[model samples]
Target: MVRKKREKDQEIGGFLKSIEKIGNKLPHPAMLFVLLSVIVIVISHFVAKNGASVTYFDAKAKEEVTKSAVSLLNKDGLFYIFNSATTNFTGFAPLGTVLVAMIGVGVAEWTGLFNASLKKLLINANPRYLTPIVVFAGIISNIASDAGYVVVVPIGAIIFAMAGRHPLAGIAAAFAGVSGGFSANLVIGTTDPLLTGITNQALLASGIDMQLAPTCNWYFLAVSTIFLTIVGTLVTDKIVEPNLGKYTGHYKSDDSELSELENKGLKKALIGLIVYVIIMSFLMFPKNAAFRSFQEDIGKNTLKEFLDNGLIPAILLLFLIPGLIYGKTTGKIKSSHDLVEAMTEAMKSMGGYMILSFFASQFIAYFGKTNLGVLVSYNGAKFLDAIGLKGLPLIILFILLSAFLNLFMGSASAKWAIMAPIFVPMMSNLGLSPALTQVAYRIGDSATNIITPLMSYFPMIVVFLKKYDEESGLGTLISMMLPYSIFFLIFWTILMAFWMFFKLPLGPGVPIFM
Candidate 1:
């Protein structure tokens, strides 16, 4: 009877496959970025030429521009594109951050430190607790930079396969925790500093007399970490995994034997990781330590400076030093050639990402050059501020607006770059703190990342799915993950609204309102 049921399921899948050939027809990510960019640029041009005139008060104070597409597109014109492209080439693009962070990550992954540790941990973990464990690990993995996407995600799939569950379900759960819960984490990460720097710049641009700390949203994010972990676990098991049904596809098991040396190496890696962290904490904790920031002002502490300015070095030592130690001890890497080879192998895996990023960067540059994002955000914020809306309604409206804009512009920093200057100031006028406003912006930006095809990581996720089921395509992956996206958008928005209504502080020294 079970065999017959399986056969029937396969037949049903075949029938549905014929009815939906949607995934195969989708454009390549590179082409999609290029095409969408051109469309937005053209629309911006027309908007600039014919749209109503409005004045913006900022660095370019008293700026006036028509709402016509042509006028909007011609606002900054080629200058914006040139500047954005230059920044991309200079390693400031998101791709650059991922690439640089992966050097250390590559060493760790190549030395089998990450995989072996995960396997060993999972081996002892209770099967019933796997969902939450994987989800939590995904969120926690953010501290290791792009390691969440590369390591936790695939391992989730593999673990699920070993447990006789659909691997895609595991992928969905992990992706939800990693990308959907992007703004929520137990620990600070490279993104925290990167985004805080941008937010600080925006605040400064508004002529605000304040110091925007990177940890401004830490408390709220920490709470959110717990919330998302529980919610992610529930949604994965109750909704996502069940909907995915049983695994009928071929999947590799994780019962393979590990060598004695590999086991010893993992043990050494664990010890090295702990020791490295302790040393780093010691070095960075003291005010006059060699590695501490050389700032003299007590208020302007060195720890803060290091958190903001020296994140790259922090990431390197946090992962690389431990990884090098593990490799040397484990015999995975004995010579300089081995180290170089590990890094080189990691770069080779990034070939697809580089291609995707090149087009994504161009699109983002074009979008900025056309000034559509700026014009829309400016006008939108102006309209909202003109009204007397306050508290929850205001936040809900902004979240929705942010989500809508996300469909067209995928880069969080880039979109915030355009929106923050206007929204922060506008919200400030309405008696809201810039930190609160920034947190709201982050929620909206993160909520939709899982659903948006325009996201740079979206294609990579699709690729990950194909590994489990050769026939799986964009539609299958999107369909499977859509529930989580919807749940996150609604639930996270509600949580933010509640937080606002309750007058909660986002983090230490962070205000709920201006």
Candidate 2:
């Protein structure tokens, strides 16, 4: 009977593996997005020609589609496609944030600053506590753009392997922190302003007189940082790490010794980074500084104007200055040619992403033009509001809906761009804060990033996995991350519920509800 059971398990595993093989051969995520968007656009045109209408509930009221395909194809609707496409393709779009942020990141990566620092930090840190520390650091690293994805994740896998644990477990833990904890960082990053800008636009669309501050969720995120770190650590060790059992593969850990020059270079980079930050802070925040972006006024404060206008440049400089200093100190970049080469190397790595982004931008723009995203979000929000759901049930439903939508639409901002206009207003009508609604949306959006193959990083992770086990592919990666996803979803949901029950502030100057 025992032999028969073992044979049966083997047969099941084989069958599953065959299915995954077929799935992995499908078109890349970018191609898939483009194809789907084209289909939606074509179908929408036909539907408009036929004057097809879809019914949806909103603001606890019933709504029916009144516009036709031709109507949607007009200048106002068509303009959105071109406009959104431009935004998506440019550095302002959701995809652009990662790519643009990577410019600085790639430089730092090329300069060996991150690699050298991680080796030194991990070597000195306690192994038993290293897992959670790495995960927490990954979450914090989001302020530095794609640094978390490129630096922390791969290093995490290496760290785990060195500690005599499964390397995949390290990847999962780091992924949970980097991707899953994306919206839960303690410090506000570039994404905060981006998301807030969209949220403010949505609020204005609803005729609300409000300013959605970028750091609105900072306090809540700080608390969540601790919560997620604990959860990531526990899940990695108790659930993910144990399941992989012993490492049977011949995956050698990174043992390359850091050169003396590299060590000195890192010290110089750190010192340079500090000096750059101090100079920037003085320029941006000093009371009597001439660098203030706006005149002090009752309505427009100097700090506010600076935050609105100068943050992007600050973000760019944060990476560029440190990176250049590191490169120069390490002798990796002594001349203008070396500097240009560093930037070129960065762009070269982005070839795959650029291809993906082109398609993703087209799809998102086309979908927005067709009003499919708006239609879906409006109807979904209406239905939930009509049901009069509140508290945990409302948040749980939102999480599932966001996760479902995430599979088809990988861009978080695009999805939020559509959903926020409808959901924020609908929830506000039901006496909930738009900030709280945004928080719930963020929670749902982030939890599934690790498991979703549509995510741009998903393919890169699969490539990483392939290095460890040749048979490892998309299915292997997704299956390994599935536990983390499910666990994070439950844990985060519960934490949100607890926060709501206690009526805790979601962030700085942001209430949990109205």
Candidate 3:
């Protein structure tokens, strides 16, 4: 049995190594977008020349419509390429939402509010209940984007070591929650707007005439946060800890707790959060509230306008208010200049994302201008119809495809930018909602993040691992995380199936079907 287990581990290690090699050979994500843009231009010219087109019934219009590929190689296309460059970058849906959201998030993170809150959650946990708290804290860290990777993950290791448990188990549990639960969160964060903007852009460019708010997946993802916290804690206590054996390593764990001032700041931040919530409630809850619309024609959906138009700013303020309060209480920010500098630091970190957005925006623009997305979606819908691949089986297949693609490409937004334009509309034609498709894509993208060496944070995880086990390497990290990835994929997919079977609303007014 021992020999057989060793052989199995060997095989798995070899397979992951191969995936790593192949994935590494792929271009940088920004460069990949550049390549995809070129491919779209070339393929569009060929398809247009061949006179290929698709005819499909438009449910919104209640009529049949034909879509043909538009060649970017043509004179008009060349002019568009030059003339629309600035607009393409500016009009990118995710650009403004992400930037606006990040500015607020930046203030919070810069104030050390996010870091202190996460540490407090883990530090105050009862020894017996530490695992779940670590996992839950990791999951909650998603609200601040990549903060969990830097803060929770290493702290998880230190906390475990202090508890006389295997630090790698701690790392596994925290990493599982942070990366594996990337898509699942209690509150709508930057990711919601980021993905929703891409989904809306795809639908609008494809002439779907429908829109979704950033909170479209909030209800389902909130539930998933609890579910994954349980799963991550179990995997750590049951599977991972036992496999790791006793900690014979001599690495010392940090025993520092949150400072008194930080605790004070956190309390004040909570007050700030409550005050902000109360203020927003007055604007949204009352029938005659500023954000609420009491039009009889819109039925019971009085807050639809706020949900659609005002949610982003609300999220921005949710982070900004608490962060500013924390900073003031902690003396992290004493003046307007200090506050400006903190915000500036946050923008500095976003320079890479901005670069990526420029290329991604161009790729999405090129894809839409060529009309290839519509043609592909129509034909793909027809193929799926012919094969009778609608419903659960189809959704599972898409999730698996997304998981497979994640092994090669790590960025959730980057992968979705390419996939959303094709699948969102195609799936809609087959009776699925854009929200449902986006949810499936997120499930796949998230489940595999822990195991993928290509993930941007993978190296950081390795660094955390090395602090406990000097001998640990990429294979060690992959092997340790493999169980979490498998279970997440299986159970998360099942949860998605459950949602589809019951036709549950994923979020407010967001249904499983179009």
Tens digits of lDDT, candidate 3, 1-514: 9999888756755665554455546665567668878988899899999998866544333345576778999998899989998998888665666667667878987898876775676565666698989899998888767667655786688678777688888898999999999999999876887788788877876799899998999999999999988888877886677666689887854457888998899999999899889998998887678887764632553665565556766777888899999999989899999888988987786676677677777777887777775665455434544565777898998888788777656667756766676678878898899999999989988999998644656644665576577666556677678888998899999889889889999999999998
Q: Write the per-residue lDDT of candidate 1 for residues 1-514, one digit (tens) a residue.
A: 9999777756645543443356546676568777877787777666765653444433222232333333324546656655667565444245655676678877887887766665776676777788888888888877755557766787688777766678898898899888887878877776776667666666677678776777888888898888888888888887677656677776666566667877887777778778877877887777676566655533444565555446555665566766787788878789999999998987887776677677766766566555566666666666766776777788888877787777666767766765677777778878888788887887777777777766656766766786677667666766666667777778877778778878889888787888
Look at candidate 1 and tell me the lDDT of residue 478: 67
Best by lDDT: 3
**Model 2 stretches with alpha carbons more than 4 Å out:** 1-22, 46-104, 141-172, 187-219, 239-256, 287-298, 301-334, 406-438, 449-477, 502-514
Query: Could you tally the backbone clashes for each prediction?
Result: 21, 2, 0
Which of the numbered candidates is closest to the native, going by highest TM-score? 1
Off by over 4 Å in 1: 1-24, 51-54, 59-92, 140-167, 186-219, 244-251, 257-259, 294-299, 303-339, 386-391, 410-438, 453-463, 466-477, 497-514
Model 2, span 164-195: residue lDDT tens: 67887788788889888888887787677767
Better of 2 and 3 by lDDT: 3
Model 2: per-residue Cα lDDT at residue 26 = 59
- Model 1 TM-score is 0.76
lDDT of each: 0.71, 0.70, 0.78
Candidate 3, overall lDDT? 0.78
**How far does residue 367 in candidate 2 sit from its true spot (Å)?**
2.4
lDDT of 2 at 205: 68
